[model samples]
Target: MSARLVLHGVCVGLLFAALAGAPTPAKAQKIYIETDLEGASGVYKFSQTREKDTPPNIEACEFLMGDIAAVVRGLRAGGAKEIIVSDGHGSQAFLPRLMEPGAKYVTGKPRPSSGLDETCDAIVMVGCHAMMGTPDGVLCHTQSSKSENRYWYNGVETGEIGQSAIVASYYGVPPILVTGDEATCRETKKFFGEHCVTVAVKRGLAREAAELYPFEETRKALFEGAKRAMAELPNCKPYQVKLPIQAKKEWYELDAKGVKGKLMTREGEILDLRDLYKF
Candidate 1:
């Protein structure tokens, strides 16, 4: 073979190898989602969450999905290439089969905090209700609506949003956006700072009823809130509620369904109901 031909062939192979090894543009950012159903717009009735074997109201599920989809849409617009959506409501309120496309859906109990960490960009919450016994909120309750009368975290009363945010803090991830009733949004803003995007889907009127915003308006708000949260990701910081987080739950009467149900844990040590959180 001629020297020039041999040299040219070697250079071409080197160029091809280098091009093949080059990393692709647009690195995918990870977004963690925690969603419930109580505060979703269009879900003002108690029967939605307290359904029997089968979900009696398909419309309720659609409302939940619509909110999830809106936030996911905004996240995508904000450059989120990956997302993990967890069902935060008790039982299987949010179905995995009906999750947003290209997203991971997790259901069942006892979520592991190990999976969420500093590596993740940020966290989002949708359709979360207010603290248990919170007056004027639709389907307001802590972990178990029927069992838990109230839950205290290091003395402060908190619902699912606060509990989950505290757990996510363990891995150094902060909650950016939280959507729920007006009261829950106020609560989230108080805990996570005013910078956090809080979207209120409904106005709490009672335990089982609420004045809901127009569906289209709410969808727009959710999407915008999510995008804003992601855009201001740098401003969001993990909310460390200080350990050992002394938590206590007031039990309900035996007649209440799901009274004996257990609360979810994430590196949490359950102390005596009366010892840590004393009246």
Candidate 2:
């Protein structure tokens, strides 16, 4: 072979070898979803009714199910390989057949330490509501409707979103996206910071009257928010609750005199319930 031709052949071979040795880009990580029915689009009441005697302006459970489906579809399109959704709401049973095929759903009351966590790369909250006593928040109650409970970490009143973020942080996972009423989304941003993507489905007025969007628009918003959240996953920081966790409960109706246990600490006239209640 001619020297020039030989030199060109050697250079071409080296280039091909180098190209072959390059590493492939990694695939996008899967997402975890935690869904609640109350903050879903069009929801404005505590009852999940869609039959006779139901309120004329009541929101249907089917509508919320569709919104959740839309979010799942969008997340899938955004390169999520797997999804696990926890039904984090009253009774934890709303729509079972509506979820996408192959998606896992966790229903029923979640234990104190059992929710979303380390198994997921990113977490998304759907149809969540604001904490108790949030101004203009729809059915704004934390945990339950009957209880006037306040969850605090280091004396700071943390909302539902804050509590959920703390749980996610326990496993080193970050809460990347949250969708709900305007008040809930606003509170989520305040607690989780600006990096978290938030989608507001409705505006509340006195917890009952609110400007709400149709199901179609809400689905679109949820889809967009999910995509944005996944895209910005790298920028999300895990929410950390500084250690030495302490829980204090003041019973309004429980009989304190009948309570029997080893007392841990007593402050003035109030007793910390943790010392008496086991579990």
Candidate 3:
């Protein structure tokens, strides 16, 4: 429901010294960051994400905000001209007071898009999790963890990371950075390639269990990763999937009693990548 665009300036005179030799100064980069809650630092349980407004969930939102702050500061330090952060979590976890000043924050519900466009130089995924069925992915699930949803595009199983990148690709934006758990990092590498920078804050032991890293250490690493992502931007490419995509989604159907019943399947063709989540 609410979207705000805040602009901040960076020291381009020194930041782009590498291009100083050129006749004209290069334009500063604009980056869009998408975030989720399940993979946030210090959050590895469903109780922290599935429920909203609870003490555990509120604390988890703060943890996610801390991680975003680090990345936003790092992106600014890395010479980003403008930055936009979106709340990609299902329940929309965003604490405006705790937000970093360098970027605009997008939260609430029923938004038209992720606020990404062709003008964006790169996209970043923060606090993202692996797809369903990842044995070592802490709190991992696709679109709906409760329904046990799973998706396949062109016969290849894809997770939130890949799905987001695919949508970014529609706008010619490359995914340059991702931060989450070890399994999530692996998933990013598998889809976005090693050229994409990934920072893992924990090592997952199971869907609800993980070896969480200290917040201080993880924040430092996320900051460094954002810097590295700027440098890695050239090497990263937008993820492309052949279309019209043969899409298939499998999920559990809840009965009248609100209990999961038989598994349901939907098969269709996605003509537009922007509508990937809708399918």
RMSDs, each prediction?
A: 9.2, 7.4, 10.6
Off by over 4 Å in 2: 1-28, 49-59, 109-115, 246-279
What digit string (tens of lDDT, one per residue) describes model 3 on residues 46-165?
999989999999999999999999999888887898999999998899998898998999998988766899989999999999999999999999999888899999999999999999
Q: Which candidate tops lDDT?
A: 3
Q: Judged by lDDT against the true structure, how good is candidate 2?
A: 0.71
- Point out the worst 10-residue segment of candidate 2 by lDDT: 270-279
Q: Write the per-residue lDDT of candidate 1 for residues 176-213, one digit (tens) a residue.
A: 89999998988888889987899998999888878889
Candidate 2, 1-279: lDDT as tens digits:
999999999999999998899864434466778877778888786555223225432245566677778788877777778888777765554467676674677776546744455667888888888988887998787665454455556556667787777767767788888988999988988888898999888999977667888877888888888877777777898877666455443222323664333423222311322221221
Write down the TM-score for model 2.
0.76
Q: In candidate 3, how many Å is residue 264 off?
A: 1.3
Candidate 1, residue 160: the lDDT equals: 74
lDDT of 3 at 269: 99
| Regions more than 4 Å wrong, model 3 | 1-28
Q: Count the backbone clashes (under 3 Å) in each candidate.
A: 0, 0, 0
**TM-score, prediction 3:** 0.90
